[model samples]
Target chain A: MPKKADNSGSAGSEETLLDAAGVKRAMDHLCREIAGALPGDCPVAIIGLRSRGDELAARLIERLAEGGRGDLLHGTLDITLYRDDVSKRMIQPQVRATVIDFDLDDACVVLVDDVLHTGRTIRAAMDALMDYGRPAAVRLAVLVDRGGREMPICPDFVGKTLKLSPSDSRRVYLDLAETDGADRVYLK
Target chain B: MADKTTTTAVRRRSGRSSGFVWGRKHLLGLEDLEPAELLHVLDTAAGFKSVSTRSIKKVPALRGKVVVNLFFEDSTRTRTSFTLSAQRLSADVIDFTGKSSSVNKGETLVDTARNIEAMGVDIMVLRHAAAGAPHLLARKVGCSVVNAGDGAHEHPTQGLLDLFTIREIKKKVEGLTVAIVGDIAHSRVARSNIFALRKLGARIILVGPRTLVPDQMRQLGAEISHDLDAVLPACDVVNMLRIQFERLQSAAFPSVEEYSRLFGLHAERLRLARPDLLVLHPGPINRGLELDSAVADGPHSGILRQVTNGLAVRMAVLYLVHQAALAVNGK
Candidate 1:
């Protein structure tokens, strides 16, 4: 099956990229792509990069279960101590737990996130993951791929490639079912 | 020197609002911190302790940040611990001692700090001979300042690390009878510990010679004790402070011989204390002076654990302050 075009509806300056239903569809599609792309089923893992990334990974796991591939393990990488820009950032980031119960050795890993921006977060997540063990292969899976590349990295599996103006507030507001009472994605 | 328009940005709470907000810009002393703020640092430290147990010990929370360890005095343990903490957080660290820096070439502390900050330094880990040196630099520089050890005033991180180590072993700080033994007058660690223990609802006994353990410290809320054996049986944890004989030249005690005979913590003295009593020391121990050689290496000694916990504690301090500064001046 070929990769379909990004189904982002045309909104000039700033718009809602994905609502609750849109997010579920994009997530279901991405999970299928990830399940197919990853080789072997024994040592497969899905890692979400803290906060909303973990939520996305949970949904991805649910989708994988529905597709009859439920053995894939999942974890979260809290890159509070691993960030490269601590001195330059405006706020002191918290060090969340990097909860990987399964081994990373020779595993086919899919690193998940809600939105992809400067690629620094993924970069940090990669550095942290390698510290655990050498994975056989690592893939980047993101729901929203906002193309403003600061580092030479891109998502291996992207849900929607939404381009925005330079001045478009590059913030993705996501509410998870785990914390907030609803599931939604907003770009403001 | 006062030409730079530096704003006095006190350390605020970091983002994500964990158990509590660590609201203090410069970690100069534990005396100024609320019990809740002190607990926040220790709790934050608890989170980082797991990182060291991992196969990969580095964290990227401070990747792009720069931490400069500015030491005016010579120290190996505190300096190395601070360096490792910064490195573990994935932050760029620069070790700047007074001997190597332009301060020897007549450059003032404020000037030296401004010069470093000019080069995009974010946090300053300072250890100075003069008291309140970090406080002076904190006001002058925009970067977050952490006093690794400032004269005889306070080694705040050391105090917090001690608390963490004690809690790790005893599981509580409240209602514990902690006797701090050794040079109370010239020891910053003693002052820091005294204040921290008082805040966490622990009963502290200041144990040393009358010259070292003055009654004035009683104002700090610690019980002034001249006799160690008298307070030994009632104590839960005994923190033996390092004897800074080099820093004190007035012959506070009659001799090294007399000091050891009077207050030296040996196996015999340890027997007088509670069976489950914990012994602690902030390193560079004088073998037979402050403590017996047996007790220094004894099972009750939390000395080694204190050293190990210092790394995580320092990491937590560096991370919390770095994050707090960022919350104030968003990236």
Candidate 2:
């Protein structure tokens, strides 16, 4: 859930587009939309991009359960080492496991993430997913769509679309099973 | 101020919820590493081992990074392995040997290193004839330094790979009796193995001639045993270190007959050891001089596994050093 905190005396101005309650409702709606269009005949793998994406994917799976498709295949991917601009980054890329147990030969993969910005993350996910096996189709889903796309890629399902400028920040603070406990998407 | 750098990473697929943190600007030797740090390298290498099995055995971990191999000494095996390991991680590698480089034209080591660093190399893999040569280079260069082999000081990766091989086969390091046989006094591999194995909780016994196994070997926490047969039964693993004839001064051991008869691991001695005994060599093996051809090729041998694990071990070292360098510079 997204809980936007108030910053009355900060240097920069802020806006709370959606709070924690709003995020849960948005996620519910997004899952309903994804459930309606997903191909039922084939094996649909709900793959989440690693770290925060896995958290978002877990929430999505819970929401999808309400729509009666809880049995959908799930996996998590780490595209850190797979990134094209790895050497350019000063920080060491933390490599985690990439678990895709089911065969992707003819599966429909719903790639999930928390925020959509440069669209480069999605592209890297696509490239990494290719190395496992060619999926029949791949549809992307995200909670917040802060549209500043550098790539030709776009999300299939977006919960909230915020057209923020370059200077504005969209920090999607998350509380996942594996990370520090907190969840909110603060736009400033 | 913190660099506020981000890696753009994903969830931990390593069955853990947290990221791995490693901090150390350079991997000077295993002697400097804590037990946890050494184990971490082995664990990290475990994740990278599967890369070799992939159809495209390349990972973009170090992609676009420049790695320089500066060697005052010639080492085809070590150099080639480092190149392949770096390339497998998608890093562009530059090779510079003493014979081919300007060092032959009277350029100082520091001058040579500064010039290479100016070319924007992110890491330097150095092997020099002098002990602590890489340590000097590490101090001089701003980039992360990996001591490939610095005379007799340490050949860290080689030691780690041997450790990796042992862990790979035996499944544990603690409570294992590992005997290091041959050229203890002159072998850099011995000096490194002593540090690594002793730190990892292995019972190490140095087995060779009295002249070859110096009194100083006891300081590394390894028992000095001149008789290979007496130690064979107690040892779970026997590492036959290469007899570096080039490094030897006059006649340290009486003769090949005397040395081989006393220390060589041949078939007759194999029956005396535990049935599950493992044999290891750091390679460029003197088959007849140290261990017989049968033992080197037998099922009990992890010599070839040592070679394969060498690649993973080196990859782990390179990746960890880069990670360390990032933490230091970023902070």
Candidate 3:
């Protein structure tokens, strides 16, 4: 169910574009749920798919730290070339660096993404992740789990679940006070 | 069944074992190689190394085979080594550079390869600027595929020669620490070395700037470090890599001087290594950038030894892959 916009902060104020505080709260809740699910002292690492997911992973790291959990390994992954539909794209996509500081062998990896939809991107991300090292298990975590999975996939922890029409496009925007004035999401 | 028996009988009658021979095919990447298969290629290469040392210098192993050097990129050392190796094994060599060929005339890579294969070329020695070009060509063509060097991908022959060179210098690969320094991100040599060295049981340390070394390299079981001093003392074989300036359009670093100061192997740095630490490079060295000339041509330098072993290793690779192809074809 889509949670009602919490109006405590600027989300209810006239300056509202989208809810930055609301997104943070939801991300924090999702992270706590994931942290609780992990076994004791089991080496856990979070690999964020590049671009927005990488930023999401970094933000999640800070939230995890606030909850007194500082033992998780963090990494950023690039899956541009590994996509099955790469050749069919009109423009040659930009390739980014994959940064996994630790070996994935036997480590429980939580693959964090900003949004989950058709499941195609997640599949490519998983393939790209495997080239680096074999993880014992991989779980998916998304901020928004919009229900339109074309492939056999489910998110382990989801911040919010949204139902959308087949033609509708949903976009998530993350902004630093340093880049843009605030953070938000929009649907068109 | 009769055709298969006849082909086997013909192979036996030729006084060559119906099992395998070296010059009739190509030697692509090592992605599909098992430990025993890799050993077979190495041991066969050792025999060819002996043949390379003989006075006659020529072998009839691939007398009628056509070995085309389809290099789509510029490479003096690797191209020359492959050409010489093919000639030594009595295969007719066709060397094509990208600029002078039909590749410049808007022809696709597969079309060009097919045109050459039409000329009865038995093996193709390919070197392209894109990773996986050889594998793509191998899938399209009926002839054998030998990858000379694909873009930051794999140089299997170079890797084999490096393995051969390391084995010759240290006499064993089982427990040695091999450090590959410089431009790890854009190096096919490093890619191949990782696979070859690991398969042979050597520990690998990849030392370079964080920008040049991919973070995923740790997944391949290599320890990544930016500080050369930290890794230098522990390495048994210091394999220096060439920093191809032509490939670098913009400076990956602030300056060459900064790179030299941080990562370049100078005389003082060499002194910190073990007394017997064998220094190596897949040559055309950028003297001051990745390595100092003093260390490159120094007493312990095995850079030239790597070049020499290139001939023997290529000869062995050609011989073994050809044998495997013949065995599969029932000849």
Candidate 2: docking tier:
incorrect
At residue B141, candidate 1 shows an lDDT of 98
In the predicted model 3, the residue pairs found to clash are B20-B323, B21-B323, B22-B318, B22-B319, B22-B320, B23-B319
Q: Which fraction of the native contacts appears in each prediction?
A: 0.39, 0.18, 0.00
Model 3, B29-141: lDDT tens digits are 76556655566566656556644554446665677888899999988999999899999878999998888999998999999999999999878899999999988998899
Kindly list the per-residue Cα lDDT of model 1 for residues B276-328, writing each as its tens digit: 99999998898988888899898898998998889889988987886777667
**Pairs of residues at least 3 apart in sequence or in different chains that clash in candidate 2:** A2-A20, A50-B10, A50-B11, A51-B10, A51-B11, A97-B13, A175-A182
**Is candidate 1 or 3 superior in lDDT?**
1
Ranking by TM-score: 2, 1, 3
Give stretches of model 1 more than 4 Å off: A1-49, A52-76, A82-91, A99-103, A110-123, A139-188, B1-16, B19-23, B100-107, B115-120, B327-331
Give the DockQ ranking, best first.
1, 2, 3
| Superior candidate under DockQ, 1 versus 2 | 1
DockQ, in order, for the candidates? Answer: 0.23, 0.19, 0.01
Q: What's model 2's lDDT at A144?
A: 79
Residues A20-76, candidate 3: write the lDDT tens digits. Answer: 786767677788788788755568888887556777788788778777778889998
What lDDT score goes with residue B251 in model 2? 88
Chain B TM (all candidates): 0.93, 0.94, 0.91
Q: Ten consecutive residues with minimal summed lDDT in candidate 2 chain B? A: B1-10
lDDT of 1 at A188: 36
